[model samples]
Target: MRAMVYRGPYKIRVEEKDIPRIEHPNDAIVRVTLAAICGSDLHLYHGLMPDTRVGMSFGHEFIGVVDQVGASVQNVQPGDRVMVPFNIFCGSCWYCARGLYSNCHNVNPNATAVGGIYGYSHTCGGYDGGQAEYVRVPFADVGPALIPDWMSEEDAVLLTDAAPTGYFGAQLGDIAQGDTVVVFGAGPVGLVAAQSSWLMGAGRVIVIDHLEYRLEKARTFANAETYNFTEYDDIVVALKRQTDFLGADVAIDAVGAEADGNLLQHVTSAKLKLQGGSPVALNWAIDSVRKGATISVIGAYGPIFSAVKFGDAMNKGLTLRMNQCPVKRQWPRLFEHVHNGYLKPSELVTHRVPLEHIAEGYHVFSAKLDGCIKPLVVPTAA
Candidate 1:
């Protein structure tokens, strides 16, 4: 079997490996048909995510056909085509019972805060990923949802991650009927957030990003309006002009802290400095949100914490709710949306490179070149 193996920091290679077999009663061995690279995978490539073992495979977003299943795995059969959730989880647990599949207790025994995620770092779970000819799916009965016959593998791939994450952001932000929603960032997740706001009945959705191509994609494919953050000196002013002097009802920060920051001088005055949150988009979101509004943060955050100007939020009585998407909870409904054509999550998939060309795919996507969005790595199954 051939697999995309992580060699080291910013290094990946297509190499031969053994076909995976079912290791647990709840496990399934699937012949991967289509798999897409995600922004999270970039973290591993950049060596930002620790504990990634050498020779580990590197894909999570996928839809594949089940080749074999353990006796206890009953939700799907050997011939079923399924969309595997990014998180490896057991369906029954304290967190799972509460619909928090990202924090499943029964999967990652070493996880003190949150459970393991597929193809993520060893800090999450060292489970092998889907960027290969075959993949071992743990908790397969609970984690892999049967892909409907109507959904194509290309289109259904992202239901494993992006679409549901975007919808979760909108839901957590409390987007409601007739509410104006602002989504910061026009990456796959940001674009999805904009679409989600529309689906959830927002009166208007404004997507913000520096990339013209992505913003255009947001409008043409995701069906939402957009703003280029680099063009606007003050995003708050631009958003206010569109909102008739009031702010949006819901504001979502989909880009996270790395995209927005400022340098600070130390009080000691020894030429020391620190970099932390400036809340560039969050500040605009706070200013662009209506009084007593909410902010949903779906962006990935690093280990460090940063500061945000809470005075405005305090005065406005804004509520803040943030989360990584619980894909298990969102999968069933998102599947329906994908099956019904209400959501075309695959529009964000702009690149489909062969497994041998993964290095090129990484370079192109990492540099955001040639209107590249989410690139799908199409590996040949063994």
Candidate 2:
């Protein structure tokens, strides 16, 4: 099998590797059919996440055919075409029973925080991801769902992460009808958040980003207003002006550690690793929303401390909600939305790279070249 292996910061290559075999009774071996390079993967690529070992594969959003299953795996069979959520968890745990699979206690040693995520890092459980010809899926009965007959492979792959996380961000907002929502970052998650806000009855949606191409996508795909923060002297003030000076009813930070508004913050957090992650987006979210409004954060960040505006949030009585999304929890409604033509997840896919050319794929995506919004990886076996 050929898998994308991480060598170090800014270094990745597709190399031949052994196909993972079932290790637990509940495990399944999936032959990947479609996989995506998520924006969060860039954090790992750039050495932002801790404990990301060399030779580890980095991919979480994937769909595949079940190649084999262990004795206890009953929900899926060898030939089943399935979409695996990014989470790896035991369904009977306290957190899983409460629909908080992302924090399942029985999976990762770091269960105090996030649960097992495929191909993330040792901190999230050193499970290898599916950016290859095959991957090992633990707790098969709880995580892998058969792809719906009506869904395309591209759409199924996105559901594994970006789509669900975006939808979860909107759900956390608790948007009231006619409320104005502003989303920071126009990446896949942000674009989807902006689009999902409309479905949640937000009267207006605005997406912010530095790139013109992504902002254009926000306007067309989400049917929302767009702003280039690079053009503004102060983005929070600009957002307030757009919301008639009271600030938006809800604000979401979809851009995580690599946010690039403040040069010093970006340097200290992203370059120097002095802080867990840059809090520019989250701080902007806190300042851009009304005093009593909600702020949803779905961006990926390191486990260490970040310099967020906790004092201001408390002073303004803002409801700040954030977590690694429980991806499977959002599938039922998301499936309905996709089935009804309300969303075309595949529309966000901009490039398709063969498994052999994945290094180039990573370069293009990291460099933001060729208008690469979302890039899919096609294994040779696919």
lDDT of each: 0.79, 0.93
lDDT of 2 by residue, 1-382 (tens): 9999999999999899999988999999999999999999998998988999999998999999999999998899999999999999898999999999999999898546889999999998999999999999999999999999999999999999999899899999999899999999999999899989999999999999999999999988989899999999999889889988999999998999888899998898888878889999999999889999999999988887888989999999999999899999999999999899787788899999998899999999999999999999999999
Off by over 4 Å in 1: 257-280, 310-312
What clash pairs does model 2 have? Answer: none
- Measured by lDDT, the strongest candidate is 2
Clash number for each model? 0, 0
For residues 149-196, write the lDDT of model 1, one tens digit per residue.
787776688888888888899999887799988999888888888888
Give candidate 2's error at residue 129 in angstroms. Answer: 0.3
| Highest TM-score against the true fold, candidate | 2
> For candidate 1, which ten residues in a row score worst on lDDT?
265-274
lDDT of 2 at 14: 87
